[model samples]
Target: MSNERLRIALARSGHTAASLAQQVGTDPKTIERWVNKGRVPRLRNAHAVARVLGVEVRHLWPTLNGRSEVSGPVGSDLVAVYRQRSDVPIETWKTMFDQATESVDIMVYAALFLHEQISDWNGLLRSRARAGVRIRILIGDPACDAVRTRGEEEAFGHGIESRCRLAHMHYRPLLGVDGVDIALQATTLYNSVYRADGEMYVNTHIYGMNAYGNPLFHLHRMTDNGLFDAHAASVDAVWCTARPLTGEIPDGSD
Candidate 1:
């Protein structure tokens, strides 16, 4: 079968076989064979193509062994580690979002701090969307058992659910904006992920401590199946099962 993923990614990235081949230092016929004849490129070529396309190699070739593509030591993708989530400078968050040119994705339970702390959070998202950056947000479903359990675990009682609802309200303005999407997920998140292009911040969720008190990891994607890709896969999985926002919060029954 043809590599539809490659074909679609090329179209979305506005790259024809000739242009992609020119960048990757290959003949256009090779690219056409990779897409039309389903032939995988060499490891280096695959990595180069994925980098130029701004995507993970595994994303274009799902069955490929991502671990085999690593060229450096483990944890090479780690950029930094913050002792506490709150220890991450606000400016860092701003820079990440501001520098994103391709995509911004978030997965959280009640990241109320983002809206409360980031200056003009909604406006920033709108601006990114207007710039043609795709944004996908997956927040916890306020009425889901996962939220309730997490609230109790965090000693917040029903406050976690309230924050989820409030977060929904804060994101309401971007509901129908082009290139922006909001979804509600019921998964038990172990780490909240905030990604802008190839870099991301991962906030670890402790059993009894509030998220702000937990550790955070800053990772930049370096290989096809590295630390960054692992978290990104989790985010994608949750996003797949999430329900899209409809400009109205779901009642408990939902």
Candidate 2:
């Protein structure tokens, strides 16, 4: 549990070992021992130190909070947390965008941002597939009962169908590229996923609001009991029940 974090916190708080020792009711030598010798202190002392430093105890020592250190294939528990889907940083999205060399998978209802916000995203996918990167995109079936229900419940007008079709329009050119596949699914999805080979970003939906306002979780591949494979498997299951996109849209917008 002991690491340089204590020292760093003390530094950030502009408090020397002697001063922090005084604040936490510890001897100056004890503080030095913890900082220099990597000695972990009792919970009481840890709490006192964290209180003085204006940080949580877990922030200082993650293993102290009854949770063991996260260890798995990718060697961490979570990648990043976002309050909403848009809260995910552009750099992070670009990292996922530029990193996939083997495959890319997507399962979403109305991922308009992919085409509207991301510059030439589908075009890049085409190029990647042309270079032998397999890609699969699964969109919600607008004609399905679930999509109509979600739209009526959320009052998003009729654009759910339009957005899905438009997104497909963006990907239509990729149909000619080998290894690229697009489909429509009727699965009831609470979360939309964007996955590459090793990592994924998940956006959890909240009823009566749009998907953009939902919480997001970033997961990475791990050896066991990791969310990466679990979510990926869920997407695969939905994909299995999905139908291939025929580029036919009832919406005249596209």
Candidate 3:
């Protein structure tokens, strides 16, 4: 029986037998056997192949579920840590955006830097969405109490709310696009989440400090219950309560 899942994943990731085998350090014939005969690779090779294919090991071989073990300590999910979000290189962010295959989820109060600092933020998102990636964006409601308090805490006065409005304006064009959903969240955000598939950047919120100045954790999902799962759950919770963005935010409002 042919391994349809492996074949589809290879197609979506633009990898053929020769290319995948070369990256996985195996012969092209072995890769062919895995697809043509449904032969599962060894555990180590399975993980290596999944990593290169930007997917979970179990996703390609369902029978291997619960058997894949993480080699490091409990904090193995942590890939890197930055003293501040600004410390992370721009190229790293771009690479993350480009490599995502399944989904891109972001929840922030007012991540103006994504647009102002990141080159072609809007264009990247649109291109990703066109590639059938599910995109969920949750921006803070500018008129909500949470936004006002966050502004006061950060000593931005009403500047934070203004920034939120500007973010809304920048994202307005994506409202009607397929595979993209934007919403207004009123929750008092404790951490801002920026996720691409199984990897994420978590910006910890600190009182009286700007978000960009706070510590940021880069995590990749490894175990079923890990730091990555915790942050991913928070994103889903907020997304459930967030109201869908319907129209534009008028000027001089709130």
How do all models score by TM-score?
0.71, 0.68, 0.72
Give the whole-model CA lDDT for all candidates, comma-separated.
0.85, 0.75, 0.85
- Relative to the true structure, candidate 1 reaches a TM of 0.71
**lDDT (Cα, tens digit) per residue for candidate 2, span 98-133:** 557788999998688887777888777877777777
Choose 1 or 2, whichever is better by lDDT. 1
Candidate 1 per-residue lDDT, tens place, 1-254, comes to 68766786687578999999999999999999999998988889988887777655665664465443233744766656779999876866876687688999999987888888899999999999999999999998988999999999989998889899988999988888999999999999999999998778999998989999999988776567889999999999998899998778866664
Q: After superposition, which runs of candidate 3 have C-alpha atoms over 4 Å from their true positions? A: 1-74, 250-254
Candidate 1, residue 15: lDDT: 92
Off by over 4 Å in 2: 1-76, 250-254
Ranking by TM-score: 3, 1, 2
Clashing pairs in 1: none
The sequence of per-residue lDDT tens digits that candidate 3 reaches over residues 65-182 is 4544245554656666679999876766776777778999999988998998788898899999999899999998988888989999999889999998999989998889999999
Determine which window of 10 residues in candidate 3 has minimal summed lDDT.
65-74
Clashes found in each candidate (C-alpha, N, C closer than 3 A): 0, 1, 0
